[model samples]
Target: MQTPFKLSLSAQDIACERGGRTLFRNLDFAVEPGQALLVSGPNGAGKTSLLRQLAGLLPLAGGRLVTDGADADTPIAELSHYVGHLNAAKTAFTVRENLAFWADFLAEGQGDPADHLAGALAAFGLGELGRLPAGLLSAGQKRKLALSRLFAAPRPLWLLDEPSVSLDVASVKKLDGAMRDHLKAGGIAVVSTHVPLETKFTHTLDLGLERAA
Candidate 1:
């Protein structure tokens, strides 16, 4: 059997700010392998900011973030995949090309790119659209292409901001299934979303409550 991936991520007394405004403070949460962290809050509650801090894209206003297991000394960006609200894809590239580029760029010595490429496309219902340019895809399809990167290169931590946005019901189910499989394989996911996602193990952190305190 393949050895399971181990991951431990925690935030303590964390704080974030944006646009000269304090979004949240003293936020804390721990995510373990085989589990998910669901971040929920009202608009401008710092949900996305918190995820960015964890992903190392934004500097924390206060407190420290800790990570254990699997290249602990490596920067969070190297060990995690951060998918923000925007679909980060090359509009000029075809679906296959986009996935292929990510698979190569983020290999991390994991599974074969060919396998990941095929699996990601199939997982997100994009197998038939692989040759189509990303810019031509519908909104939902663009979202799927963005999400396929998670599978294209297996990362231990996933920081997703509003991952379910623009997804159809069927696509949402697919996303849930992918998360379930990732957790089952000992991967960790931190998702900020208004849409409820069904997973086997989940922990929720409400940023609105953190902001109110």
Candidate 2:
């Protein structure tokens, strides 16, 4: 069994800029285990930028982002599963191959390979298309496959940007279930989306209105 670990994340006095234009500044929020932060805003409001910064993909223009109750030395990128707007799948690879690669690449010494792969495929309703080439999948199917990576690896933090994009109502519900399960397992998530995710343990951060004023 995996050892239990406490997880917490916070951003203090955060600021971000793109092309010399400030998107948001002085943003602050905190999320503990079993909790989620829902980031909502209009286009160009820096919702994606915030998630990228938290994922350690983009540099923080200003402020401190902290992760507590875990190994202090481990970077946020290593502890997080960042699902961006684009589906990070290899078009040439089969669905199973793409998922298998992620399962091993992001394993971080946790979860059984076979079990996690199977569970992820099933979770996204992609079991039957496992052998099909990813390039052939519909947009929704590719999104599902991309999201399945969260199930294939156990990460304490999830950084999602418009995760429900290209998904149907049923698939959206499945994504919600995945997020719910992640939170229940003591994982923290920061999601940037326009779609409302019906969950009881979510906190909202409206970058558009907050930053405009």
Candidate 3:
């Protein structure tokens, strides 16, 4: 909480293992505010594993992770939003209801205009379908719904995994803008993408070459 280093990520000899196989080890890196870390690698390179570790989902094999700056003093309960492949789409509720549920669950305040699902719906090309049941949406549409949840979140850290998957070209561009705005808003994003990014990376961390086992 002392702002030891702005936007800090310090992992000393960090390692991870899955299914008895060591995924990666002795990995150490740090990124600061106004910087984005692009995580890329071939499939099965432990990209997701590293992101999960940063999000505090998976335990680090040998080291620790510390995020400061805007996230200083923020509890893991409040520091970040971890979004992956899970479909939070409600088979029974409309898209609006799904986001509403998220806002309440994340303890976000009500009557917040920025939490508008409509704007996100339009940005993602799902405007007309906000009233429709999420279960009725196509796979791609479902992914868009997942993205809309971010707007209603107050966390400063974003852990996104392969967010570009299943998105069309235009949707990917819109997604890019959303991510950029998040960074511009002083948020930190750690994303793992197999697909290309729309903008230059502040830094690229390759997990494939860093595997320790």
User: Which is the leading candidate under TM-score?
Assistant: 2
User: Deviation in angstroms for 161 in model 2?
Assistant: 0.8
Clashing pairs in 1: none
lDDT of 2 by residue, 8-31 (tens): 999999999999999999998999
Which of candidates 2 and 3 is the stronger one according to TM-score?
Answer: 2
Query: Which lDDT tens digits does candidate 1 get at residues 85-196?
Result: 8888999999999999988778748767788788778889899999999999999999999999887777889889998899999999989888878888888999888877
TM-score of each: 0.95, 0.95, 0.86
- Candidate 3 residues lying further than 4 Å off, grouped into runs, are 1-7, 70-73, 109-125
lDDT of 1 at 142: 94
Q: Give candidate 1 misplaced runs (Cα > 4 Å).
A: 1-3
Q: What are the RMSD figures for all models against the true structure?
A: 1.6, 1.5, 4.0
Q: Which lDDT value does model 2 have at 193?
A: 78
| Sort order, lDDT high to low | 2, 1, 3
Answer with 1 or 3, whichever has the higher TM-score.
1
Error of 3 at 115 (Å): 3.8
- How high is the lDDT of residue 110 in model 3? 35
Judged by lDDT relative to the true structure, which candidate is superior, 1 or 2?
A: 2
